[model samples]
Target: MIPSFLVPLMGGSDVSPSLLTFKSLCYFKCSMFFSPLGMVPVSALVGFGLFDRGFPVVGHCVEIEIPMLILFIVLSQYLKNFKTRQLPILERFALLISATVIWAYAHLLTASGAYKHRPELTQHSCRADKANLISSAPWIKIRYPLEWGAPTFDAGHAFGMMAVVLVSLIESTGAYKAAPRLASATPPPAHVLSRGVGWQGIGILLSGLFGTLTGSTVSVENVGLLGSTRVGSRRVIQISAGFMIFFSMLGKFGALFASIPFPIFAAAYCVLFGLVASQGLSFLQFTNMNSSRNFFVIGIALVLS
Candidate 1:
């Protein structure tokens, strides 16, 4: 489960999956809070069964998502001639088209049976040796201590973990703020923000319980996807979360996603990260950038970051 979260985080650290993943978390959170009953429908829609099998396509990472982007650009340009009322839907339609094209290419490659001859074509091809879903019970080797005992506490390790958690909180705060904006929604209320932070703490607790060395943090790439796709509905995000949990429980299902081609993900990142940058720039409007203090703060932060 930890690896599952970390895998996307690792991929996103270099690109923009962090935003995409964060957007998905917002969707999940919103759905759970406002539409708890929507879980069943969402689960059925985005279940692990969706990506059971697929062949890999061989190409430069950038090529995978470029055609989709081109399609979006062309569609956006064409839609400019339409009335304002129709423009929003048309823009969303263009995004949908882009997604369809990318999926079609992936499906085409898979259906072509290319992997039979070129196993390396798939991302994490080495995983073929592992079970699609881990069948062993997670607690098979677990045991409880026979007597009450005090364990030595290492202040250095405690402080290190605290530092990491603090950094994670800062990043998560930005993600929470950005997620709503990207979804075309208002910023979360104070209570909701507190809840989100509390959830992070809970996640860390669960990670420790599971013996994981590190804790989880929200992804920023998913948030970027919200801006690109303009799908801010919490119901959709809840469904995504459901899929993640469901897949983690089913080893084979999780493997299916792992098998996705790198180029396809990279292509999506190309579009998403652009939106993230644009969204970040939009924040400048609220600031008094003309002031020397503000200017230096922003400039130094940008350069250092």
Candidate 2:
């Protein structure tokens, strides 16, 4: 629901090309900016019992996640050659296919009672079917403005949220820069960025009014997807946004996706997030690596982040 409203809103930017040239310093600074954001999924993988108390753990979600990771990579590689006319459907949608296959496998395991005697956390994270969410969700529910309650503000919370918004802006900037490069387009001009930020602010306003948990920002991970699949059509994104909105109204539909095993998502993230990190580093080619100043700046930024 949040993404459905947010994506199109953010996409509605009025960008005008500029006659000015881009600066190398700007490229250098933006290059490694997304490195930290890219590694967030790796941290999530670790939290999913990949390691326990600093020691490696096995057979928790390791069994499922390892296979899922490998499968996604294999499918993506194999599908790269299989195309229909001009569109590489297999390659472009490899992520979806891999996820669907693995999810079905997990569902089979659940039906076989594989997790019946496991710990509560294991069952909760690995199970394909979540009866509670499905049962609790209505068949059709439309979100209304202030549906949760009337808006309230606090000085302390407002300050903290403002900090988060600042971070979100920085992340979105990196995403904006990366998207053009991934799509084989020229870097966005200053005016384009301003327009994007303006639209993002409007999306955030709508998110608050719609009772979303967080405001909208350009998704860093999806930028990686653009790099991976080589699909950069704005119409595709708008269609996806429409699906999100449709699913939001169908309560059970949303709950169905929520029930996908957590480890499966983690495995997918492993591939996607790694690509994001690499994409950030790829920008280094545009900078003067021979310069000591550049190295020092990169080191400091990475370390601090």
Candidate 3:
């Protein structure tokens, strides 16, 4: 129920597991969507379970899903303490609903008849062997509210995609900034986190153009690392990033990275993201949202659902 709103969106169908996975990729954009990474693994498991019960779309999603999920969990947690000024409840709700509606709209408009189709959105392109991507269409495709949209790689769309990249890179920047400090250094510089986020932006924009979302960084696991170590130094995280760069250079890393269990990461991430959000709420000056006036504002958000 944690993903209470998402269950019905994918629309269950009775079919073979492979077909289900195909359907999922086509419609859900699963990995490509770059959702929280936590919820995704869970949704895949559910889809797989459905496939086992004779549903469809349960192929190899779990194989490639786990490590990316772990990375996502760790990065999300690491950023738990970084607070942007809180938006009014009405604003938050508006943003959430608007995103959902846009996703919904995109899903329907691009379908081929009743079956969603996007052969270009496959996972075949994201493996580490590739050198790079120079276009932006791939990144836009990842926002797969529904996979049926006609995701293209034409250079004509680059202008609009550049704008999208600017925002996605901004988000990537935020995630990178929230990681652990490395080494014996007590804390790292604000610039280091800034640079980290910038890296995240560049990574995703390029990868996204290839119809992938693999380049984004930061993990939620570092939250548990944070809660245990009580350290938020940027130096330590930079060290960790260096290590990742090293491991990534190894050919086998991609295979090994893909084998971790999906459900494990998703379940842990669900808890981690909620905690991160709560920690953000802890930043409020008054910490007094229970008042009648506050309730009215919060209620408006819930009503949109």
Candidate 4:
């Protein structure tokens, strides 16, 4: 039985092992063995049993979508060098605009019954699985309305969460350093780093209050996008965050946006994660591989991981 406290961390780690470290893995393994999170996966598996089977075509689309989009972006940028023809504007924002246009077109096609005969196409083209839930749910209800009396504190469980939080902190520190470099900005000031860590703790508290059961951390994916797009403006990040919060409050809008096809999301993730992994490897420039200590550490980490 998976411990409940460790479940979320395990879930996140499963999504991307590239972001974790040897120490984190050791901690996770120890936590898993101790079983601090408590049979969370059993409940989750039961919940998943209620959903329809996922489509293989959607999985295939996800696998190739990002690379294809990256290739398209690169080709479009390269073709811009042709002096004879005036090409349409193509930049980071332009790419997003084009994606929005395509998403809208897909929805239109779905609505117009273009895929009426292809049920799989319709299923894979967009998502709206949560729309019904959101529409039927009460807006102002507290997510966890009842308290199970006084909280029973378990030292082992608390330690597991603490270990995960420490791991998250280490990862966030690396992200903070990497994000600025990717954005072509100076490394964050000491106070800024402190504040960032502090805010992450606050976010964790808020998540618990909101019943998310997950801790917050910097996204390597977005940092990688900063590197790929060459856009480092903090205002852009703030605005995007604002939009997320705004949309999250609008259930229908959020559900609609969530309905974006897997292929589209996967394409973006592929490019972003690839860039992130590459950027992480680029950090090796500062390390002397010729040194046996450094070589063994790096070698063993890679092999073990």
- Each candidate's lDDT (Cα)? 0.51, 0.64, 0.35, 0.52
Better of 3 and 4 by lDDT: 4
lDDT of 1: 0.51
- Report residue 142 deviation for candidate 4 (angstroms): 9.9
Strongest candidate by lDDT: 2
- Model 2, position 250, has a per-residue lDDT of 98
* Total backbone collisions, model 2: 0
Candidate 3 colliding pairs, count: 27
Provide backbone clash counts, one per model.
20, 0, 27, 6
Assess candidate 3 and give its lDDT: 0.35
RMSD of each: 12.9, 8.5, 20.5, 11.0
Q: 119-189, model 3: which lDDT tens digit per residue?
A: 43323321221222222112222233234432333333444444454444333332332232211233334
lDDT of 4 by residue, 134-166 (tens): 466444432441132222334465566666777
Off by over 4 Å in 4: 1-58, 62-72, 75-89, 108-157, 189-191
Expressed as tens digits, the lDDT of each residue in 31-89 for candidate 2 is 34444334233222222222232112124577567778788888677657787897777
Question: How do all the candidates rank in terms of TM-score, highest first?
Answer: 2, 4, 1, 3
Ranking by lDDT: 2, 4, 1, 3
Where does candidate 3 stray beyond 4 Å?
1-200, 204-225, 284-291, 301-305
What is the C-alpha lDDT profile of model 1 across 26-47, one tens digit per residue?
Answer: 4435432422122222222121
